[model samples]
Every structure is written in structure tokens, then in C-alpha cells.
Target: MPHTYLVFVWHMHQPFYKDLATGEYQLPWTRMHALKDYYGMVEMLEEFPSIRQTFNLVPSMMVQIEEYAKGEALDPFLHRALKPAEELTDSEQEFILKYFFQANPSRMVYRYSRYGELYDAWRAAEGNVERLRRSLGAPGMRDLQVLSQLAWFDEIFQENDPEVRQLNEKGRDFTLEDQALMGRKQLEIIGHVLPAYRRMALKGQVELSVTPYYHPILPLLCDSNIALQSHPGVPLPRRFQYPGDARLQVHKALDYAEEKLGFRPQGMWPSEGSVSDEVLALAYDEGVRWMATDNGVLGATLSSLAGVRETYRPYVWKQDGREMRMIFRDHFLSDLIGFVYSRMDARAAAHHFLDRIRENARVLHNEGRDAMVPVILDGENAWEHFDHNGRPFLKELYRLISEDPGLSAVTVSEALERIPATELPRIHPGSWINANYDIWIGAEEDNQAWEYLLDARQTYDRVVNGPEGAALSEAGKAMALEELLIAEGSDWCWWYGPQHHSENRPEFDKLFRDHLAHVYRALELSPPEHLSRTILRIATPAYQQPPSGLISPRIDGEISSYFEWMGSGIYSPDHRQGAMHGRDNAVREVRYGSDGQKLFLRVDLEQQKPGALAGLEVRVIVKSVRHESELHATLLENGAKGTVVRSTRKRTLGAEVSCAYSQIFEMSVDLLSMGGRSAEMIQLQMSLWRDGLPLEAAPAQGWLELVPSEPSDWE
Candidate 1:
């Protein structure tokens, strides 16, 4: 038979979010994903007997999930959500209003009626979380509480489980008893997640793999200097070469997965698919049979082979009496499912994917070689943007795959059993992202984070090797070392650079610094004074870039010209910041600038259908220290017409607000008409709406304020 192997590895991971000093889980992602993706991702595999996939479970995430299953995690969101609505304190109520809606507006929130209603109310209040909390009576609060939790339930449970079905069916006016039941069901569901994956592995429907204990970049652990090989001249921190930590992380991951899943993980997916010769040697020594990385690494390692054929096959690194099999993921195919398919119709998307796969298979067959396609991506974070949490798309894709005789879905090990791996003398030193460690290092924030880690590590060594060493028990030193390992995780730096954004980034900074502090606390010593303050140099105020100079762009709802909006201020929605990492990014950014005559605004959206932008209402609000101005327009299908309105805080602006639509949404209003002429400073905010519900808002925190730079500023 002509073989076409499909290797699917769903990389499941989350950072160690706990602060040992306070025993607090700084974030709730692990628990949230457990309820939403972990079990269901594997559980759905049962429907197709012929398909087998790999699930790469990271140890740090596993530990958190286990704690949540036992109801021992001190997650503020979990505790706050379950508390009776009437018993919530002012702060607690405020927390609920702020964080409960940290979800996708189109899918997660709008999928349910009551949740959408509550969210709409919260949005219309315009930052009045406390007022919204007060306005929502006990019944409304209870409904919000129950629905927030329910919105994250697995697709299978939402449809099949009787208790879950009833609560979802009840939909509104939840009771105290209902909240109690909701709490129990959530734990119960989390408890089943691991065992379900184990069952699938045992039944031969799936294979399980493991990453490092704390999901650190193993190459950097071995030698931070290695980063310079992939990215020369990238500024680095003080040398931090800890091969011992890298060895321990790999060894512990295999042991932990064995203890938790009842079998040793045969394959390894290094954190971020990062690999180097040193890291590979460690994995091979730890008894790992095969490991996987991204296509960029493969391309960089073996520049001789052409693109597609070289990418869709396995390879081996044999050097110095050690051998490790490797698979390079098809980054484009993996990203299509991760970032692109969610915006498409399930059937059309699935068929489009199948067509591409078939073409790849045909190409390989003609070349007298079999195709081995490796698709890998984050299992949890991409789903919220998907329809029904990506279940429909997966089902359709899998069904088409199963019906095709030329395609066969297989695990990494099974694929290795059938296809031979090409040999390579050396491996590249980089990660799955752009084939560089720049995401975790190089940038100012990233370099500072590493320096902090180096300082803490040296302090621990000093405590152990110095005069007070012999008196210290080994357990206490080990405890301190464990905290250091937790701090070494790549996730801390993942949020540090200009690359990503999250509403919970402040909490991440606190948790990382707290871990460093506990390294000393565990050793019975005081943490350094510098460690008391945050390593995050700039506090994130929902991210903004100020305008440089005055501009007079034609309001034609198009780019007009590159120079027309060249110096325009960009007010990107905080929610859209993670587009590169697969988060909900419906609208890309809001471009605004002003001239002597009028202030102009443009809304840029992600790729959409012809009529897709029509229904969305683009609303812009401008406020001076003295007055406010508003512009409202309902985009029509032909990109032709919309209703225009002008209003202010005190009274209507009455001036004509010009609105237009084409490739972008553009509007302009005279400054004098909006009361900005004599004002000290002008503040702008913009939002997107559909069906009376707010889809997204730019400058999610604080206003986009500027002093209205003079036209000569550009000169």
C-alpha cells in the first residue's frame, strides 16, 4: 500500500501559575482548559476507530490539573464563581464583572442567551463594573455565575451529560442548589480528564507524550550562550549554563508522566519544540525514543532539501554514540487549523484541508515516496475562537480523513515504525517560533528576566556552598531548588517581550517574582531588596501607541495611500494582541489621527467575507477634558451607506459626522464640532458592535489620550 501517514500532536501546556510563598494559583487557565479541552479533545477520538493521535501533556500543567481535581487548588476565580451571589463582597463582585467576561465575544459569550444579555449590560455600562454588579439582582447574579462556568463546559458534556444538559437547559434563574451542583460537576469533570486520555492510550486510539517538568527551554537551560548560535549578536544576560537543571527537567518529566499515566512516555515534545544537540543528548539519555520540533528547525538544520518533501518526513541525529529520532511538524498545515480554520465554515474548511492533504500525497507518490504529515499546535487556547470549541471542524476533518483510503492517521511512534528517518549529523539550536529563541530571550524585558533568574540561582548556590550550608537539611535546599526550576519556565519570558499580551500579565509578573522570592524563603533567608519589586519595567495599561504628528487622510474607508495614514496613532484592542499566538482577533486595530479640519478614525478587521463587515456597527467616541463626542454608523452590505448620529455627554454635537466603508471602516468629524478646539487634551475610544452586543473595544483600559500634536511636529 502507498502510505500517507497523518501525525497529529495536540500540544497541551500551561505555565506553573502557583506562588509557593502564598500557595495561591495566580491564574485559572489550567482549570479552565481542563473543563473545556483536556478530556473532550481525547474523548472525541473514540468516534473514529482508525485514527490515532498524540497528546503532549506538560508536567507543570498536569500538576495543576491534579490539584484542581482534588479541589485543593486556591484558585480565586474558582472560589469566587461558586460562592452564592448574595454573599459576594464588593471586591468579589467587582472581580466577577471584570474577569468573568474574559472570553470570546462572538463564540463563548454570544453562544448563550443569558450570558450574552449579562455581557451586553456590562458593556453598555462603559466600565461601570460596580454599577453593573449592583444592577444585576440576585437572580441575575446567580445566572451570571452559573452561566460563566457553564460556557466553558466540554461540547460532549454540554450535549450528552444529563445534569449538565439540565443546567444548560434551565438557562436562567439558577438557584443556590444549582450553584452547588455546578461546583460539584466542574470538579467531577476535571477529575475525569487525565483518566480519559489514559483510557484512549490504553485502548490504542491515541498516544501520550511529555514535555519538561516546568516546560523550560532545555537548550537555554543547558547553556544560554547557545541562543547566539541561532540569533547572532542577540544581547544576552549573564551566562546561565545549567546542564544539570536540563537533565533533571527531562528525567522528571518521563518519571512524572509514568506515575500519572501508568506508562513511560516514549516520545518527547520539547517545550515550544525547542531543540539543540545538548538537549537531544539529554532526552536520548533519559530513554526517549523520538522527539518532535518545527519545520523551521528542520529547514535550518538541513538546508539541502527542498521545502515540502523535506518537511513531511522524519529524521535522526546520531552523534557521539547517541541517536534520537525526530519529526518535524508541517508548520503551515498546523497553523491553518490553529489560526485560520476557525473563521471558516466547518464543512468547507475540512474539505479544503483534505484537498491540500491529497495534493501533498499525490506529489510524494509521484516522487516514489510516501507522505508523512505531522500536524501540531496548542490544544486549548485556539478553541474559544472556534465554533463549538472546534469539535465540529475536527469531526468533519477526521471523518473525511477516515473515509480516504490514501490517508492514515497515526501516532508519532507508529509513524516511525512504518517510515524510516533520514540521518543528520547535528540539530539546530532554536524553537518552533521563527526558528529562534528570541521569544524567550534577546528583548530588554526577556534579558532582564534571565538576569533575575541568574541572580537567584547564584544566591541558592552561595547558601548551599558557603558556611551555613552543612547545617541546612537537604530537603530545604531541594525545596529552594524546586522553586528555582519553576522560575526557569519559558512562560515567564513568553509574556515579557513586545511579542504578546494578556489581561493577566501583571499576575504573571507577580507570580514569577514571588517564585524567586520563595527561593530564599525556602532556604530560611531574606530575599534581596531588588526581588521585592517587579521585574516588569513597564506596567501594561492595555497597550497603546501615541500619535506622532497631525494627519489629513481622505475618509474613503480605504488605505487611501500609505503616507495618508503613515503617522496615524494605532489603538489596538487588547484582545487582538495575541493574533500571532492564536487568540480571538476579529478586529485587528483602530487607526486614528487628526488634522486642522477633522479627526479621522479607521477600523481594520481580519480577513472576512464580502458582506461580513456590513452588520457590525463601528462606533467612535471622543472626549475632551470639557466635553464628549460620539459617532455611530451601521455598515451596510455594499460598503455604500450607513446611518450617522452625533452626540455628546451633555448634548448632541449636531455637526455632520462623515462615515464610509470599504476595505476598512473610516469616519471623520471636525474638531470644533466635537468640542476639542479649546480643550487641553483629546481622548478617544472605539468599539465594534453587532446585534446590540459589543464585539470588541480598543484601548481596553484607559483612553487613548493625545495632546493633538501640531502639524509642524512632523517638520
Candidate 2:
């Protein structure tokens, strides 16, 4: 009677966006996600009493939610959303055009007909304020105001709330009353986020967990050098060792949860599923009975790959008289839900997910042992990409899980009760990414941010020990320390590194520095000059290097040898720009080169799997002075069969291509086919398409250019 226990931990969090000095929230995500995700995620569970899950709520997010619920949050976005359309200044109109349509274009914006119309109008105008201002009158602005807010309302709210439903029916030419009603409804939804979780936890339908206050990486707080353990030779900032701060973050989270939620949380999903031996000790000391991190960490700790059997069980890590149970998230399953399933039909995705779980479970069952599959990921951000905000998918998944006798969806705590723990003698020190701290440390920008934080911490310590600090009020000292803790948050470093990029890069840069500057202001000290400037460098576009020399390699779809393409022109896409949470970039880097007779191109993927590239089409478009031509390649069957490479133009290259799973994808085309003879300059553009959707494009902003080599030089 072996059964599979399914653990779904939805980590809900938003960075602390409030400026303590100004009392104004800098970002509207906390409010936006509150309206769309938090309450509804829990409320939807009521439909299926048999299914149970866990929700990890970060205290900082809850604090902001409370502010919005009480109408104390002075968020500029809210102010703009609530403003009368006719009274909006030109700048305000411009701001609306820039940010109001920030929701998912396909799922959220297009869901509302009027909002889609406004988005199309603004897009058609090429985001020009003057053109949009002339084309879209007050009526357009009013409709945008109502529909922008209305688009974020949870599917449940849209279905149940009369005002929201009426607004949906009205579609366009929304009145001032409609706008005012949307604003009120937003606050009303925000109010439900916390209480709904409390009610769910109380009902035992969901288990509630908490992350560290301000969501700092506890291991790094304990010591920045800990990063070197996972990533040896990584350039680090000045040694930042502050176990006390780490302890405080954990302690505060537990205390806040007990006070706010009317119950003590027994489990902690440390910020970003970041953990170490030291972090475990801290959590265990704080009475955290269980914790979770990605399976990559578990694999690294065991010095072997974590397969299904290794990852599908609970384990105990006991060191130095402190212990806590741990679960490693099924990275593949979780990512499929977060990234892949959004592109799939709801029922099909749900069935595929459940079938995978069942198939995986059947293996363990055959061995006469039960299995535990932990599926954990960010709960809020993925839904925007999903139709109906993923409600249909979740309902289908939950319904399937509830009906299956062999499968049981349980909270982490519930799973622990039924499952026996295996001993993990030691644990790896890393976050969920690659089981390494590279995302938060090692990078030049990440190191610089740590150095800045170290200086601020040193200043605080010196002032507090000196007579000037002793004479300062207790409130001032506390504020200074709070700012230091906020600066310790992992979010600042997430954006600082080269690993990730987003549209709001400058804002994050400013916010991180602002928190550090506030630390000095709280201590009555002048902030450093560096604090006033940005830490972020203007990122170079995707085309980093041009073709250096001729490269003629076998079109075997693999990096056959080190020297095969050494001098190839490389184009690495800057994925940080327009970065969406949980979305994986399929195209890692692209290289192009040419021998006198043929053109060679290669694509490296972030992941190397033939299945991942299956159904994906890659196109290399070349424009020369005289003609334009394209080479199309469709990846299939781990590159074994069904992959076809074709050329569209009068000249054909006899194109050949290959796909190497977990390696490179390469192709070769005849130079004469590309008009290389008549062309003096050649421009290249590479695009990856899946199901007709452009997944990624190289040279994101422009085309890669190469001046054709002189015939004498080619000789």
C-alpha cells in the first residue's frame, strides 16, 4: 500500500519596496500580486477539501500588504490609477503609457477587450506620448484606468464581485465611478490576502511557512566567505561575517508570524531556498522543524546527481547538536509548472504533470517504498503568463490529484509525519540556482554591492561604539540597524549580478543604494559619494564579438573540439533585460563564422536536452547589399530524425545541421547561397521560435553586421 506524498510549497514574496525615509512605496508589485495571487491561491483550495498544500509568506511582503489594506501605503502607482483621467498631467499620462500596461500582454492585458484596445493603440503609436495623447482622448484614459486595475483582479474575484463583473461587461468608456470602484475593490482584495491564509492554515487545508524578515540570504549574512565554499576562487567582497544579523532575521520572522497569523510557523523556506549548515543551525535554534531547498544542493552535498529516488524523500541534517528535516524540490517538475506548462493547454498540462508524478511514484512503489515529491516554486509571478491567471490549470491539477488514490497532496508538515527521514551527514552551502552562490556573489557588480554594504555596516558599528552613537536616541540606532538589515536582503544582489536583468534595473540599483544611504542618514552620517551614483553598468547588447577568423567545422550539431570554433564571432544574449521570473532562456549564446566556401553557425542552450529543442525552429536571416536570404532548421528527436534545414532564396546552400543534447546546435550553409560574393557588408539575425512564438532573438536591439572579407585577404 505504498503511496506517493506530493508536497507543493508556493513561495510568495516581494522585495521590501518602501523607502523608510519617505514612507512611500517605490513599487506596486506587492499591491498588484496581492490583488491577483495571494488571496485567490488559498481561496481556490476550498473547492477541493481533499487537497492540501503549503504557502510560504515572507514577513516583509505581509507587512506591505497590511499597509495597503489599511490604506496607509502611499504608492505612486495607486495614486495614478485612482486619479481622474481629465486631471492627469501630461507627465502622468506619459507614466501611464509607460507602466500601466506592464501586465502580461497575452494573458492579462488581452483578457480585457478595452485594455487590449488601449494597449494596441499605444503600441501602434510606438509608445509615443504625443501621438497617443492625440489619438486617445479622456475616454481612452478612463477606460485604461478602469481596465488596468480590473485586469489584475483574481479570476475568483472577477466571477464573484458584482462591481468587477459589471466593469468587465462595460468594456470601454468607463465612468469616473467605475474608476473609483476599481480602486476600492483593489483594497478590498488586499485585505483578504492575509486573513485567507490564516483561515486556510486554521482549517488544516494549507500549511503556512515563513521566510526571514527582509528575505536576506542567511548563509551569506553568517559569512560572505561561505560563498567560496560552493564557488572556490570566486572573487568576494570584504569579509562580511555577521551571524547576529542572520539570527535576528530568522527570529524576527518567527516572531512576526506568530503575532500576525495567530500561530507559530514550524517550517521555514529560507529566502530563495538558500541554506547552509550554519543556516540550518540558526533555523533549528529558532524552532524551525523543517526546511526546503533545490535538489541540486542535495546532489552536490551527496557528491552525486540527485535522481528521482534521492530527491523524492525527506532527510535530516544534524550537526553540532542541532537538527532539522529537509526536502529537496523536484527541479524538473517545478520548472515544468513554472515555465513550460504556461505554453500548454490547461487540461493537457495538468494530465501531463499528474502522469509524470504517477509514473515516478510507480517506480518507488514497485520497490515497496513510499515516495515524497516536493514541487516548490514562486507562486505569484508564473500565473500572469498562464491563461485565466493559471486558475484553470491549478483546478485541473488539484482535481486530478484529489481523485487519484495512489497520489496524495499534502503539506510539508503532513508529509514529514508519514515519511521516515534519511540522514544527510553534511549539506552544501548554496541557493536554489545551480546549487551555488554565483547569482548573488562572485560577479564584479555583486562583489561591489557587498563591499558597499560592508562599509555601511562598519560605519554603523563604529558610530554605535563611539560617544556620538551612545548619545543618539534609541529610535535612531534602531532605525540605522533596520536599514542595515534591509540592505542585507538578497534582492539587491539578484539585480546587481550579470546573471539577471529586468526593465526596472535602474530602480533596483537606486533602491539598493537608497537603503544603504538611509543607514548613514539614520546614523547622522553623510553617505559616501558612491551611494549617489548607480552600481549598474549599461549592459552591452547581445552581439559582443564579431567574426575574428574563418571557422569551418563539421555540421554535427556539437562542439566537436575546443579548437573547432575558437575564433568564431560570438553573440551572447543579455537575458537580464525584460527578465521574467521563472522563465528559462533556451538560447544561451550564438556564434557565427565563415570559411571562403561556407557559412558556419552554432547555438548554445542554457539547457542541453534534445526534447527541450523539439518542436523549436531556428532561423538565420542574412541580409546582404543585393539580396536577403534565410536558413530554417527545425530541431527534432534529440537530433536523430525529422530535423530539416532548408533555404529560401534562388540560391540553395545544401544546408546541413545537427543538435547535440546538452551540447551545441550547429549548421553550415554554402557561402554562395548567402550572396556572399556580391555583398560588401552582411547583416545577420538569428531567432528561435516555438509553436510560432518568438522565444528569443539574437542582437536583441539590432542586427549583427560583418563586412565581407576582401578576396585577397580570404586567400
Candidate 3:
């Protein structure tokens, strides 16, 4: 009988967020995610003992979790959350109002009526601190403090823990004891996360794996110039070559995991799934039996598109008498869970996922070969976007797989044991994105960050290995080395590039440099002046051009002619600064214009028809000086045909708008119905919505201004 082995590896990681010198955490993510994600992820698997999987824990994240579990970690975010409402200073109150409601608006905030009410009030105030202060008294502040923490408690804790359940039931008008109890419950959850993984792994329901000690890109650490292999002619930072540090990172990770979990880990995810011949050799030396990276890398290495048959099996890479077995993740399947599935019904998404897997497996089985499908993605970040932190969907998926006799869920190691492997003479040097390191290198900002890291590394070598380091105490030397390792992490460069963004961009910038500064401080040397300044410089914005002339394009959704929208206003999002990872931006650019009587819009997307936009909705909002109106277009596929159904313009306000889809999305609105006469100018914004959740938006910062032309201007 033929079978499809499903290998699900969940990479659990957070950047090293603690400041060594101050003994304070720069961010609360490590603690917050531990409370919300880590414990539940492993504990839930206990329900389906037959479905086994692997969890990759980075050593940096483990240390932070340990500190948090012991109640030894502190930060401004935690302090503010724990403070009594009456004792909160005005600035602290403002900070709470600004940052406390930073959870998923639909899943987390709305789960609690009080938290949702406070969020609505805050939004209604339009971020006016004075207005918020006047509306929300000490009681409101207390409610926010308790509800903010309560929202992050895992589903298991919410259902089983008495204190957490009591807080959830109370809902509003929380007292000081409630806030204190929430804080204590948070620590209790953090304590459970590591133990839960340990317990599961020992029970053989889970396999524990790990990354480098601080999550550095091992290939880059071994040789920075390796990036040039995939991306020639890319501007690189100063040459940084150190294979010794690469070796040390791997060894340290294995040793730490063994010490903490009571058994040595046999597999490695290699931070960011970054690998090269040199990296494989280093891991091989560290006793790593298996590893994983994106299939895109496998495709580039094979110099062909790696189809299901090519990617659904494990491979062995051998060079210089060293070998390591590897599996390439099914990128599309992994991305669906990470980005798309959250907006779908739980049971439907699970069935769709299993169907895709079975279809792929059927292809291999018909070829008389067994199949192994590897699905890998971040375990923490995706949950917030899901209802009930993704429990229902996971439960459905696991349950279906358990019942299906043809399918079996196994860890990477377990699958590798059952399936024979193909041998590759050489492998490509790349990260997950596009089988290239362009996201972490090449870009000006990325190159600059690398240069800064190089400078810090050189300083550490010169001082610690020289006569000056001899005078330093052993404790100081250890502290300096720890700082250097933390600085080497891939996270700083992740934020430096234009590919992704978060509201805490500046904080990431500061923390990266601060770590380097501590390295110099431990050596008793003056830090470089450049360390005080940020690496980010203002670059060209992504949006380009405003409407210059009239456009009356045909509304068949196709770009009928080159000249139809030649002078239309255009807006493009800077991809480097996008908010999420592993998501495709359906809209490439938005062009809008007016032909005296009607306002015209053409959405140029990277894809058309039943591609990325299928089963999604695009919303167009027009905000005039006095009024706001909107139009909705739902994308659907009927059999083999695709069509976009535009709803009757809700909040029409006498506006006659029509939409069509062909090669592009086109819409036109009657100017008279848009309150063009009532306002001198109007602002327009477009957003991609799924399951009523706004996934991504154009302009990102503010609305695009559209000025109504004077009647005589046409002449």
C-alpha cells in the first residue's frame, strides 16, 4: 500500500530581545508569545497522539523564556501592565492607551467586550490622548490592564485555569487584584511552555529540534561573500569571513538543547533555513542528522522547477566527504496556512489542505513512488490572525489526518527513516526568499547593517584576543562575547530591508545598535559615533505620480490600450516595507482618474483571473471632506471560469459606481453621486479583505488625495 507521510515542522522563534547591560527586555514578544502560543501548540498535540511533529526552538528564545518563567524579566511594557491604574502617571496612561490594544483587532480584541469597547473608544478619539484621558477613568484603565493581559492567555489556560477563567468571565471593571493575578498567571503559563515541549518530546509525540545559539545565518557567518553566488553584482558590506563562529553557533545550540531538554536534538532548522555547503559541513560536524530549507532553494540548486515529485522526497547533499539529509518545504502549502487559511472557515481550510496533499501524493503514488510532504512555517506569529488562536483549524486538520489510513503525520526524522533519499552532489547557497539572500543583503540598508556588524565583530576580536582583553575580568569577556552573538542574529537585518515592517521598526533599530554598543562597553572602549545614529535613511517612497489628465478607459477589466490610463494617478506599495511575510500582494498598482462626469479606477495586479485574488474581496473607499462612501467587489470562481461580483454600492449617497474584471480591475463612479459638488477634494484608499479582515492596504500611511478638477480646466 502506498502512503503519504506528512512532515509538519513548526519553527518557534523570537529575536533575543533582552538588553544584557540593563537586565531589561527591549520587547515583550518573547513573554507574550510564550503565554499565548508555545504551551498550547505542543499540549494540543497530546490529543492526537498518532499525529507527531517537530518543533524547532532557538536557543536565544529558550533563554528568554526561562528568564520570563522565573519572573526575572522586566520591561516598560510589563511594568505598565502591572502598575495600579490610579498610580499610572499621565505618560504611562498615554503609553498604555497607545500600545495595550496591539493585538489582532478581530480575534483578540473583540473576544473580550471590554477590550473591544476600549479599542473603539480609543479609535473614536482619533488618538487624542487628552480625549482618551477624559473618557477613560481609573476604572477603564484597570479594565484595560486586566483585559489586555487576559486576551493573550492561551485557550487551554482560559478553559482550565481558575484565575484566568475568572478574569475572562468578569469582563469589565477589573480591580487591582485582577491585574496582579493576570501578571502571575502570565508567569505560570511561561513556565508551562518549555515543560510541555519536553513532556511531549519524551512521550514520542513530538521531536525537538533547534537553530543556532542566536539564530545567525550560518552561511553568512561562515563567509559573507557567499551571498554573491546567488546574487552577483549585489553591493555587499565589508568582507566578513569566520567559519569558526559558524561552527561554534551550531555546537552551542546542540549542547544547550541537550542540557535543557534532557536529550540531544538530532535535527536542525538552521536559522531562516539558510544553508550552503559550508553550513552543511558545520552542522554535520555538530552531529545534525537532518535539516530543512525552502523548496525554492532546491529548485535553484537543481537548476529546474522542483515539482511535487522532486520536492516531496528527502535528499542527501554530499561534499568534501561530509553529508546531511535535507527536506524542502512545500512552499505553497506552508504559505496557505501562514497567510491564507486564517481567513477561511476552520473545517473548510483543513479539508482543502488535506485535499491538496492527497492530490500531490496521488501523483507520486501513481508513479509507483512513496511521497513525503513537508509543511514548515513560523509557529507563533500566525496564530493571532486565527480564531481561537488556530486551535479549531489545527484540531480539524489533525483529526482528519489521524483518521485517513493513507496519510500519516510524522516528524522529519521519522519520515526520513521510512523514505529513501536522493543524492545531490552540490547544493545552492540561499535563504528561503526566491532562493537568494537579497532580502538580508544587497539592499543599501541591509548592507549597512552588515557593515556595522562587521565593525563590532572586528572590535571584539582586536580587544578580546589582544593584550587589552587580558586585563578584563573573565565575566566581562563572557558578557562581551554574548553581546556579539546576540548582535549576529538574523532579526536585525530582517527589519533593515524593505521587504517587511512593523510599528516597532525604530525600536528594532535601537536594540541592534545597543547590543553592539554593549560589546564595546565591556571592552572599555569608546563605541563608534555611528552606533548612536540609525541605519535607516529616507529613500524613495513606493507610490508614484498623481492623476494628471482625464481617463475614460473601457470597464472590461482589461488594459484595452496603452494610452487609456497613461496620465492616471498611480500608487504602489513599497514591497520592502510590507507588514507580513509569505504573502502575495494581489494589487500591483492602483491608478485613478476622472473624465469630467465619472471617477475612474484601474487596479493593476501582479496576477489576474483565478490566481491569488480568488475567494477574496477588494474594497474601494472614497472619503470626501464631509462624507464617506464605499464599494465592494467579491472575487469568485465558477467551475473553470472566474468572475468578480460587485455588490450594489452600499452607502451609495447617490453615487452610481460600476466595476468589471478582465486583465485588470476597473471601476467608474459618477462624480455627481460622490459629493463632488459638496467638497473641493476627496481622498481614496483601497484594501484587500478576507473573511472581513483587512489583510493589506495601499499607501499604508494615509489616504491618497484626489482633487476635483475645475469645469473650465478641461478646456
**lDDT (tens digit, per residue) of candidate 1 on 1-715:** 5679999999999899876655778677888899999999999988999989999999989999999999889988888889989998866676777778888989999898999999999999898766787789778888988899899999999999999999989999999999999999999999999889889999988999999999999999999999999999999998999999999999999999999999999899999999999999888999998999999998899865436788877888998999999999888899999999999999999999878887877777888888899999999999999999999999999999899888999999999988878998999899999888999999888898899899889989998999888888998899899999999999999999899998877668767877887787777875543443345665333545777877888877776688988777886555412321122456677777777556778788875654567777766667776666556677876563433344544545544477777788888876665454532577877766554334455654356776665532211
lDDT of 2 by residue, 1-715 (tens): 9999999999999999998987988778999999999999999999999999999999999999999999999898889888999998876777777778888999988888888888899889874678898788888988887788888899998999888899889889888888898999999999988999999999999999999999999999999999988989989889999999999999999999999999899999998889999899888988999999999999999999999989999999988888799999999999999999999999999999998988987888899999999999999999999999999999999999888888899999999989899998789999899988888888888998999999999999999999898788899899999999999999988998778978777668778887887888788875654464457766445648898877778777666798988778888877534332223668788888777656667888766454556667676776776656665667765662223244455654443333343256777655565544623667777776553334556755457776545463221
Q: Which parts of model 2 are misplaced by more than 4 Å?
A: 539-715
Local accuracy of candidate 3 as per-residue lDDT tens digits, 332-356 = 9999999999999999999999999
- TM, every model: 0.76, 0.76, 0.75
Largest lDDT belongs to which candidate? 2
- lDDT for model 1: 0.82
Model 1 earns a TM-score of 0.76
Each prediction's whole-model lDDT (CA): 0.82, 0.84, 0.83
